[model samples]
Target chain A: MKQLFVLDDKKRTSPIKVLLNVLLVCILLVAVFWLSLSAINVTFDFSFLGNFQVRIWQGFLMTVFLSLASLILSLIVGVLSAVGQNSKILFFRYLCNIYVGFIRGTPLIMQIYLFFYIVGTAWGIENRFIAGVIILSVFEGAYIAEIIRGSLLSIDDSQLEAAKAVGFTKMQTTRYVILPQLVARTLPALTGQFASIIKDSSLLSMIAVIELTQTMREISATTFKLFECYLFLGILYLCLTLPISFISKRLEGAFNYEN
Target chain B: MKIEFYGLVKQFDDDRVILKSIDFCDDIHTLAIIGPSGGGKSTLLRIIGGLILPTAGEIYVDGEKVSADENELQKYRKNIGYVFQQGGLFRHMTAIENITVPLIKVHGYSKEQAEERAGELLGRFGLLEEGHKRPAALSGGQQQRVAIARAIAAKPKMLLLDEPTSALDPEYTTEVLDIIHELKQQGIDFIIVTHEMGFARHACDKVAFLCDGQLMEYGESSRLFNQPETEQFRTFLGKLLEWNV
Candidate 1:
């Protein structure tokens, strides 16, 4: 017989980690606050948020419009790529494979530069917003395509066969039975992709699209308050990303608890 | 309705033949095909369900030569409900949603009508309470029942069940068999591929013993069970009954 020692009557639970994590967060917040204050003089002015609010708000709107436009294009590309990959036809399968590889193999930033400078300029399109949206769509579409493909493959083969057995044509089966399940399964990935799109909107600054971070960069250059501007920008980015994160988590929880 | 398999042969490459010129006919409500493993029983069922084509022969459904025409085959398949060995439930849909799917997608029933029909079937299977549960949340037996309910919710003219109870516990086996027996009584034609001799003897109207991709023995359940005509069937029966003993 083996003898074991039980030190405590109760097992240690999440309490310590919760306390430590909160403390760590507070410490990080203090350090960031201290650095921000030390880097620039503290001035409480509501004018930037009010006087320049229109420009900032316009940039915010532009960011949202760019993200939405890119999302729509990416949705079409992603769905098509996923379907092509799942197609029984060899040509379509190979085509989708090549598209995924070509997009994912290259860095998004390089692609952005290429689209903005080479492609858009060559086409005589001066709008940076158009270039930004197109680049982001192509970049994110590849990732979204993979997510959709995985979800489609994750579906049971028997379900497809069952649909066929019921006299559903291939198109009908794909449209009705397969697509709904795919959408539900890929919901989280879509939310994640949307969050990435929000952060990636900051990259539009390079293209002079004057989105959130660009607005901050411009104001900070004139005001000489890089810390204050960035902190505000960080808070704004968090505002944008946090809701999407919350919705994704809620969707995941609902899906899991549905059964 | 009559289903005919005429000299059906399925060969892989030039050497191996899974089903060799197999000929069978059935107009009965319930036809059970019993055989040892790898006897091509499932291949036969798949061919009848139009899931797979016979490489050499033609299959006629209800006096219509339907196999060659792809479009006609699609229409013919509307009347069949195939329950694979695994429950093959969506795993994502609630039990009721899975059951209502065929009605909504293929039969063109409205969502409300589909749910109503599905609710009735779930109630019949004693799964009304479990209707909102996913397949993963349910026990194996419950999942199997949900699969069967989904199959029949389409009100298919025929049902093909492939070794449905093989993966189930004994208690659950009885539950499924009881449901099948009830379905048979309600005049739902069934083509069952089962290893359960007890279900074949008690529930199935007729039994066909297949071996080596051939129907070696087929007759009324009594004759096939008590006095199997061939030595191969006798060996198969002896091995199968040995487990029961």
Candidate 2:
């Protein structure tokens, strides 16, 4: 049995600090809840939400559509860029490095602006969904590339050497041996990247996509109930994200090496 | 039917020559190359396996010159199976998948036949129980055994091993050597680079010594181990024996 020394030691590292932390968290929650209730004029009536559900449903569908489209684009870009980044030849690495650097170094907001206003107008593609999809995918692709490259790098060198020794052509080695492990190892990161994309989809409201946040904005403006609309919007966001977080956590646990 | 190297020279970047004028021929059952570190022993094996070409020299496998035509060397390579120091099992693949990769990728075997043969070979090696496990989940000895099984799964004519048992424990090393001996009984030729002098003395049909990319000595294993000829070979054994003593 392990000793309870850490719990017993109270001077520098005590349970008091933990108690204080919980107390602070409770106090912050109470303050926020109180402000929200008073500001929204709490009336215990959810009738507005009943009428609002239809628009919310449509907006949620659009959000899903945008997220799925962006995710597919991001995956393609991420994989290609990662392969390019780790290419044996120097020129390919340089090309991938410059692309990743240019995308990641700039702010996502600037990228959105470039896609929505500059490129979208020039190309005459006025579909906000298309512009939003392109912007989010390009932005998220940079981050996904790093995650993929990291997973690929983590693979053992002996693995590739073994494939070669077994008389696998380079393409065969990658297709059969390297790719399967790469996909498995990067799954959790893929989920995290998808979650980030969902959250960032709120940025589409600026371009008038009428996603959930936009619907909430329209409701709050009309009702003059900023706190109520946002409170419900927060609940909707939680409903979407909580399941993703729970599933990803379960995946991580299931695949954990318990040895 | 014969492989010989004449005036073979290899250098990494024109500065440090790893192998120089290595000249030898081996038509024996199991020929072992044993030498100290950085002695270009593995370089000789790699060149023989046709994984790398010598910067200057001629290598003939079965009377076909390797350096004369690049395409000819590739055809010769299909007959050789090289095993690395590490088992080098692909982590993503189970034992069966790893074993059958050569058949599917190189020999164009149908997946069903390849998998069936893989299962049979793995069963022969007493690894059927672990056929579904990935390399990461397997023990070092088991992974190496699986590697050996995979190497021979395609039924190559010659096996080239580079320090196959160096990373294994003493017991595992004996197990691997036992497998090699069993393969020798079936008349499969092997060019092994290893540091296990005991195996070199007992199991090998012939032994070759390499130093600074040169063939120091080559003879029957019993004669070479008992009565080493060259001064360099004698001195090398003297130091190794001192360590063992």
Query: Could you give candidate 1's per-residue lDDT for residues A136-234 as a string of tens digits?
Result: 888889899999989878877877876777678888778766877777888987998999988987887988888888888898898776666787788
For each candidate, the alpha-carbon lDDT, in order, equals: 0.82, 0.81
Q: Which stretches of candidate 1 lie over 4 Å from their true place?
A: A1-24, A28-51, A86-95, A257-259, B12-16, B108-117
RMSD (CA, angstroms), candidate 2: 5.0
Query: Which lDDT tens digits does candidate 2 get at residues A78-138?
Result: 8889999999999989998988999999988777887788888999988888888888898
Candidates in order, TM-scores: namely: 0.87, 0.87
Off by over 4 Å in 2: A1-47, A86-95, A249-259, B67-75, B110-112
For model 2, what is the C-alpha lDDT against the true structure? 0.81
Report the Cα RMSD per candidate.
4.6, 5.0
DockQ of 2: 0.39
Report i-RMS for every model.
2.9, 3.3
Q: List the residue pairs that clash in candidate 2.
A: B1-B62
Clashes of 1: 0
